[model samples]
Target: MSPEDRPAGSGPQAALPGCYRHPGTETGVSCTRCERPICPQCMVTASVGFQCPECVGRGHTGARRATTRFGGVPVADGALVTRLLILANLLVWVLAAYVFTPQLDRVWSLYSVGLHRNGPEGVAEGPDQWYRLLTATFLHVEWWHIGTNMLALLVLGPALEEALGRLRFLGLYLLAGLGGSTLGFLIDGDWLNSRGASGAIFGLIGATVVLQLRTKGPLGPVLALLVFNAIVTYSRRDAIDWRAHLGGLLLGALVAVGLMYAPRERRGLVQGLTVVAALAVEAGMLAIGMGLYGG
Candidate 1:
């Protein structure tokens, strides 16, 4: 008799199993671990064979996630924080340039004495305006000024952020900027106004050198860049606040050393203490600046 006419028990079967996760799909493949039917969409590659999503997830439950060298969670997009910082600087520039104009300078720029055609006004002259030290870092008027600083930030920020992780990198930037501001305030004449992200950018340059040293990477290019910038800073000392650059560079290097060389057993504690100490130093610098400005 023909095969079609054969009885059910005597005929060959042609049916396939449906996937457990997707019942509507037919699949001949099974999960290696669970031996459950799974479609291509539900398959995760394994050493021996393909596994189902559930099996893969179960295997990962006891495994530790990867982290960066400085105890930061590794990120796929390393430049995220850097981009945000650049955007913030750009936005502040836009506001100071068009929306706020000269008014922003009087209110937010870092200066001990305010001497204007109208009258005397400034950060030191006002009560509780210490925040100007930070706010001024984001203020810029000249196109070339902001352009150069932002370009440097775009270049150095991502790598540092990748090495130190988002939070630590951000703290480094803010603290370095504050260090620059405090030193500039202390050194610059009372009438001189200081504003720009150059200090923070200098800090990034400093941190980059430290990171290269810690990782045992080549130092030629970084050192060349540092030397070039140092020369430029000195050359333009008439216009630039070299003290801010020096302060930022020093603080950034110190912070990077703390972050990179902390004992593995007490890494977080040491890092926290380092940051606190840095802040205390900045506070002390601010007090000295105030003393001189008052005198």
Candidate 2:
């Protein structure tokens, strides 16, 4: 190839000046970096000459993606933890409805009565009944109960999980449920059986609202929704455990505050400890409720 025929950025490999991708197609332009002959289609305009798309992509391969202020990796899809929680609740609800008459609810539901209930013989009871704290969040009697809770979860879980991440969100949910159960069992003395995911759902709401507040995002919508739900809960006092909802909401908000205020270098540790502390508080509450720790 003549020297005059060589492009400004041409290298020895592009001496003949045929497109590397298309041997028959002549390309006067060469990649500004790699200096490979590139056809018009392969050329990516640059400040100097032109670069190949491959070279441009290679240049960016080492670059890290942008993350959220809370250090969460940005996601394009919905929350996996939320979906899994919904699925588990649905499966448990189905089994409770079909496979196990009323037995599942009786065993899993949180009752105001003691762990050792004065009920029919052969019924499962004792310390193991303590599992009701978490299990009750999964068990729902009425379809509307599950439907409302699931819908609220569908709305709230993704946003909260996006802010807190999967593991922390999971911890928030469980601790919220435990907190709700502990408070309900201690306070709601007249109510016999209480079971629903509303407490956990309320926790998700609280987390979302607090996250929005921490990020300085709009909080009107979330606060309004919370107020409306609280009103609805109070209106249905005959049926709903609003006390549990309140407890879970407060606990979730406190956890979110701790998470948001934690040092950036030790955020994960602080988050984990925050959840553990919440659990410890719930445990203490339960022991007190059960008269085990000098209550």
Candidate 3:
């Protein structure tokens, strides 16, 4: 109503209406630049998130907060992502194996939502076109790979989704896969042929690891599990792309932290922004890696 009470910063601008992140807090802080009344607790003045104390301590005199209410806690709707991921991969594999029979001299092509390995073009030449980013994650070279990954997904996905809510869970799956693709592209090195959901699967691993840390799970087992997987991926040297796995793991870890720690409403927003950011970072890294390793 009054000038001072006109709500500070873009307070809660990014979050849902009447659904402030922190129900306990009230005085919404506006972004200094935008005059957006953000919840002092859920404020993101710059790129990073901060609380009222930290925000004020940093000497940010830009804007302030307005009155607000916390939103509902997000909920999981089964492992929607896990099933979608599985279906996509299986469909691609079926098409590739059955519908589009491979030939010795020439290659037959089928489209999948996730990335796919082209003959020799590597990723640059590969069919990673827009659809592949989503599809490539579905298909795996071997049934065993899919089975193992799927099992892991079953073990982790539902729980993760429950913790992150269905929406954020979906975001996690997608962003992790994107990160994995980035890793694959950077490491493929003119090889031009790779596929699988390990990137996202690995992302699940990373997320789980973070969850463990957040809940203070025994550090030794979590660290060991990661180490074992990294060792396997790197040493396998067969068809697996450890780089993608690494990227997924790294991205997953970051995403997990963001989801676990960031405000609930911001989960979707953060995940969306993180995915976009991951893509840009992945593309940049891909370019650099191509230059250095393209050989």
Best by lDDT: 1
- Put the candidates in TM-score order, highest first: 1, 2, 3
How far in Å is the alpha carbon of 270 misplaced in model 3?
A: 4.8
Give the 10-residue window scoring lowest on summed lDDT in candidate 3: 104-113
- lDDT tens per residue, model 1, 95-201: 89989898987677876663332223454453477888899889998889999999999989998899888999999999899889888876753665888888888
Alpha-carbon deviation at 156 in model 1, angstroms: 0.5
lDDT of 2 by residue, 141-199 (tens): 78999999999999888878787667677888887877788788666433357889888
Q: What TM-score would candidate 3 get against the native?
A: 0.61
Provide the lowest-lDDT 10-residue window in model 2: 117-126
| Every model's TM-score | 0.77, 0.71, 0.61
lDDT of each: 0.84, 0.79, 0.63
Give the clashing pairs for model 2: none
- Once fitted onto the true fold, the runs of candidate 1 whose alpha carbons sit more than 4 angstroms away are 1-63, 114-121
Task: List, residue by residue over 6-76, the lDDT tens digit for candidate 3.
Answer: 66654544443331445555553555543434574456546544334444556656554321111114433
How far is 31's C-alpha from truth in model 3 (Å)? 42
